[model samples]
Target: MKEIQHRSDCPIAFSLDYLGDKWVLLILRDLIFTSKSSYGDFLNSNEKIATNILADRLKLLEANGFIKSSVSPEKKNKFIYNLTEKGIDLIPVIVELMIWGSKYDSYDVKDVVKKLGKDKEGTIRQLREKLSARINSDVPSNE
Candidate 1:
């Protein structure tokens, strides 16, 4: 991994240095909530991310340890992206964003966002557990 220079010592600044862009978080959202993995899947998102930017963000995310990519077992020519533990840990932050957006923006609160708004901690706990299980099960056992 390449070394990243931080603009400041603050934790938020450090995090923002990598994830400050809208596209980065949206890519993460798809990985966390949807069945998206391939480059094509991301390109087809409602946001209609440009090809060049999507490619750049995917490379950056993988380099920064938020995601890992593996060749799809069923389709040798294709790749699948999965969240790392660090990425999975960002669920709470994403949930908080959803809560904040729903509250302040005209965004319609979806079922998941409604749950998050109602019980933030509980909702985060449940999402983390589910994501953790999925990530762990996808890992091949050494044994």
Candidate 2:
């Protein structure tokens, strides 16, 4: 991971230091909103991110504790990425961005956003729980 140079102690700046890049957020959006998890899945996103940038961002995300990766059981050469607790905490932020973008930025309203409109807290809670379950399920069992 590249060392972050904090310009100041402001909270937003600190966040930007980690998540300022559009690609970073997009990757997080894919992780949160879609079923995509593998490197090929990300490489094939609608945004058509370049391979090099995707590789760099994935490494940075893992290094910064937003995500973690493990070898794919079916494909030894591939990896499956999952959100850590820190990354799961960003679900609300992604939801707000989706809502704000749909309203002010002219982005299409996704189904989750529609649910959010009806019940913001409930929608976020459900998303968090779903993601937490995914993380828990990924853990290997001793038995």
Candidate 3:
């Protein structure tokens, strides 16, 4: 991994250095909430991110330890992207954003918002557990 220069000592600044861009967050959102994993899947996202920018952001995310990529078994030339523990840790942030967006932007996330409103911590825990299982499932056990 290449060394990243910090703009400031603040935690928010450090996090923003990696996640300040809309595209990066959107990509992370897709990884967490959608079944989209391949480059093509991401290209088909509603945001319609440009190929060049998508490629760049994917590379950055992998380099920064937020995501990892593995060659597809069915198509060796293609890669499947997955979230790392670091990326999975951002789930709460994304959920909060969803709740806020539902309230202000009037997004159609009412079902999720309602669940979160009833049990925010439990919802987040379930999400993390599911995601953690997915991530762990992708790895081979040493046993």
- Which candidate number has the best TM-score? 2
User: Per-residue CA lDDT of candidate 3, range 17-72, in tens?
Assistant: 89888999999989988888889999999899999999999989998888888777
**lDDT order of candidates, top first:** 2, 3, 1
Tell me model 1's lDDT, rounded to 2 decimals: 0.82
Q: What is the alpha-carbon lDDT for the whole of candidate 2?
A: 0.87
Candidate 1 lDDT, tens digit per residue, 1-143?
Answer: 23478999999999999888899999999987788988999999999999999988988898888888877777777777878889988988887787777788886668888777678888778777876776676644212
Q: Scored by CA lDDT, what does every candidate get?
A: 0.82, 0.87, 0.85
- RMSD (Cα, Å) for all candidates, in order, is 3.0, 2.7, 3.2
Quote model 2's TM-score. 0.92
Deviation (Å) of 83 in candidate 2: 0.4
Models 1 onward score TM values of 0.87, 0.92, 0.88
After superposing candidate 1, which stretches have Cα over 4 Å from the reference? 1-3, 138-143
lDDT at 136 for candidate 1? 73
What lDDT score goes with residue 47 in model 2? 97
RMSD of 2: 2.7
**Judged by lDDT relative to the true structure, which candidate is superior, 1 or 3?**
3
